[model samples]
Target: MKFALNSNLRPLQMALLGSMTVVAVGFAGSAMAENRVTYKSAKAGTSYYQMGVELAQAMKEGTNGDVIVTLEESQGSVQNVMEAPSRKGNYVFTTPPSLVAAAENSKGAFEKKPDEKYKEIRALFPIPSLTMHFVTREDAGIKSFEDMAGKNILVGKGTFSANEGTKYLNLFGLDGKVNLANVELNNAVPALKNKQIDAFVTAGSFPSPNVIEAAASLPIHVLSMSDDQVKQTGAARAVIPANTYNGQTEEIVTTSLPVIAYTTTEMDDGTAYTLTKTFWEQRDKMAGNAPWWNGVTPEMLMNVSGKMHPGALKYYAEKGIEVPATAK
Candidate 1:
């Protein structure tokens, strides 16, 4: 026999059901508040991509999982900038200030696909600079840029190193006198070991993995550039401290292209502030694990191009970190 609801118990049952519904809604709302940001950087296995992975972990843990970061593979900085205009939600990417300047001016790679939306890009935080490493085989007898005049040098094709190496060779009047190896950077170490190339130019943060590998496997020398030479290249000056690699004894001065994490106006002020704040607060922690991150400092913020995201600016202002007027 079907039993009818007892009138006295009906009120208690309704109240219990209402309370349960309210608790469920609260949990759902909390879940919805979690933010997911897409981070696009270099291709897999590159230092930048690895940094993205570390940063993602730091963000998740530091925020107590309120913020989640997802890393995406990118061809290079140009491709990252190209996607910024079309990307929605909270999107972040890393690139050199020069590329941002070019994109803003619709020059170089951005010339054909220039979009007004590019103007919305904003700076978040500075990352490690792409420091140049002029690694030469010890037996090659190369001590400086001038020594590469007759040596076989491998500057990986279509990379920043290749472009800068060409410019430096021409600047020092050794253009045609040197043999530039045409090969991928992944082959540089093997090529150098096999005596196919006497030296190679690679760009990454120091201690650059490739440089460390070269220095560890064979006797190597990192060429130093004069202050005047670095100035002529028109890139940021960087110094690889002594013993950065296995056998390196003296600091090697070189040029670097500053890279920065960037986002667009689509992100809310709160989220931007959280990201910027978390980055600085957790930077030292990140550095303890990855030495490359140790290179990042508040002073590097001066290199940031475009305007700063308001949230990031807020953090800087609160922390008394001086930001460039141009980035303000």
Candidate 2:
């Protein structure tokens, strides 16, 4: 094939080819500009997972599809933080600030396999907190932490609630005095109804579905902690306002652990900025649909443990939000 004389095309043909090349390049650029982030949270059916879905939808709507968020089911906060070392490119996960601090220090869950990448993890924004709920049967006669001394309490295994509940009991001097039930949290309401356990502890955002379900089926009591008790736990204080659930008359003051969305240093500053801005801008809209979102506020940033992502920091600064010195 010796076709060497066609070195130059006609002016119109050359112009068309050049225009097509420009169009092709523009399409490529547009694709590159589209940021796709993977959002990992809790199990598929949990409240936290639902929040992830809502946040994904909000991100899409707020960014006009520029920033597309894909949701991934996570086992728990510990798993979320553990996977950070190997995850790549715009991966965001939710976890309590304490767990992030643990990962950074190579303590607790990360002690067995510490990763240097954990230090690179950065905070995005706070999400709804995990509020502790001490639910009891109305007839159980257990109203305060002290009254639970002789009760059978189910604090599900391998969760923040279980660990914190055990700690609180010990801190309150109950120790081996209480009969701690060894069972899953899913059986809590049924166990209580059957008189198998006097009370159970759960940790979630306020108006927890499990609490609502229990309250709806049977008369229940939500225990309130004293100011001194809350301070002793060294956790953030949260209040479940009265009438939040059926038969819930008085507000229950409780302890809370703040949860936050976090990303790694690998994410570009622009994408992080967009994600953070979109989250706050759409928060009210999300809250209108899911009450859990209502718990999130700018002030909760003080609870974030690690340094803020530079991109997220940029958005916060623009809004004049007060970021904690520890997270700055």
Leading candidate by TM-score? 1
Count clashing pairs, candidate 2: 0
Runs off by more than 4 Å, candidate 2 = 1-8
Task: Kindly list the per-residue Cα lDDT of model 2 for residues 118-227, writing each as its tens digit.
Answer: 99999998889999999999999998888998889999998889999999999998999999998789999899998999999999997799999999878999999999
Q: Candidate 1 residues 263-285, lDDT tens each?
A: 99999999999999999889999
Computed on alpha carbons, the lDDT of every model, listed in order, comes to 0.91, 0.92
- Distance (Å) between predicted and true CA of 283, model 1? 1.1
Candidate 2 residue 293 Cα shift, in angstroms, is: 0.8
Highest lDDT among the candidates is held by which one? 2
What is the alpha-carbon lDDT for the whole of candidate 2? 0.92
